[model samples]
Target chain A: MTPDIIYSGAGMVVFAMGLYGVIASAHILRKLVAINIMGIGVFMLLIATAHHDTLIDPVPHAMVLTGIVVAVAGTALCLWLAVVIRGLEHDAASHPSQ
Target chain B: MSPMLFVDGLLASGAIALALLSLNAREVFTSIVLFVCLGLLATLIWARLGAWDVAIAEAAIGAGLTGALLLAARHRLREPTSRDDTPAARRPHVS
Candidate 1:
C-alpha cells in the first residue's frame, strides 16, 4: 500500500478511537485528551493527503500548523474552565452554604 | 516491502497504539504522558509524510505545550483530600 493510504487509514481509526473516548470517558480532563486525539487524527489525514509520490503541498502543512496552535489553546481554555468548576464545587462542599 | 514502507507502517501503528494506551490509562498522569508520547510519534509521522512545518509545530506546541498544560491542570484538579476537616475549617461551622 502507498504511504498515503496507510496513514489515511490509521488516521481514521485514531479518530474513531478518540470519538469513543470522548463519549465513554467520565472525566472532563479525559474528554479533553480525547478531543486532542481527534484533532491529531485529522491532522494526520491532512498531512497524508498533502503528500504525493514526489511532491508536497504547503497549504495543508500550514493548515495543520494552525490546527496545532488552536488545539493547544482550546485545551488550555478547557482546563481553566474545569479548574474553576472544581474549585466552585470544593467551595460549596466545604461551606455548605453561601 | 521497502525499508521506507516498513518504517512508515511501524510509525503508523505505533501512533495508533499510543493513542489507545493513553485513552485507556487508569491514571490521569499516565494518560497525559502516553498522550505526549503519541504526539511525538505523530510529529515523526508528519515528517515521514513530508510535513516538516507541521512536524515542528506538533513537537513544540502539540506535544510540549499541551503536555505541560495537562500536567498543571491535573495538579489543580486533583481530588481534594485537603478538604477533610482540620479544626480551622470547622471553626466557622462550630461558631
Candidate 2:
C-alpha cells in the first residue's frame, strides 16, 4: 500500500477514537481535547487525500493552518468556560442554601 | 519497502497509539500529556507528507501553545483549595 493510503487509514482510526473519547468523557476539558483530536484527524485525512493527487497541495495546507487556529481558539474558550463552571461548583459546595 | 514508507508507518502508528492512549487515560493530566505527544507526532507526520508549513504550525501552535493552554486549565481545576490555605484568604476582596 502507498503512504497516503496508510496515513489516511490512520487518520480514520484517529477520528473514530476521538469520537469515542468525546462520547465517553464527562469532563468538559476532556471533551474539548477529544474535539481537537477529531479536528486533527480530519485535517490529516484531508492532507493525505490531497497528497494522493499530488505530492503536496497548498490548499489543504492552508486549510489545516486555518483549522489549527480555530481549534486553539475554541479550546481556549472551552477552557475558560470550564474554569467558570468549576468555580460555580465550588461555591455551591461550600455555601449550601437551606 | 522504502525507508520513507517505513518511517511513515512508524509515525502513523505512534500517532494513532498516542491518540488512543490519551483518550483512554483515567487522569486528565496524563491524557493531556499524551495528547501533546500525539500533536508532536502529528507534526512529524505532516513533515513526512511534505507539508512543512503545516508541520511548523502544528509544532508551534498545535502542540506548544495548545499544550500550554491545557496545562493552565488543568492547574486551575486542580488547585481550588490553595486560595483557602494561603494568606490571600484573609483579604476579603470583591468578587
Residue-level lDDT tens digits of model 1 in A2-72: 99999999999999999999999998878999999999999999999999987788998888899899899
Candidate 1 whole-model C-alpha lDDT, 0 to 1: 0.88
Q: Report the lDDT tens digits of candidate 1 across residue range B39-94.
A: 99999998888788888889999999898898877766664743556664333221
Q: Write down the worst ten-residue block by lDDT for model 2 chain A.
A: A49-58
User: Which lDDT values do the candidates have, in the order given?
Assistant: 0.88, 0.85
TM-score for each candidate, following the candidate numbering: 0.90, 0.88
Q: Highest DockQ, which number?
A: 2
CAPRI verdict on model 1? medium
Q: Write the residue-wise lDDT of candidate 2 on A1-98 in tens digits.
A: 38889899999999999999999898877898898899889988988876854456689889988999989998999898887888888878888992
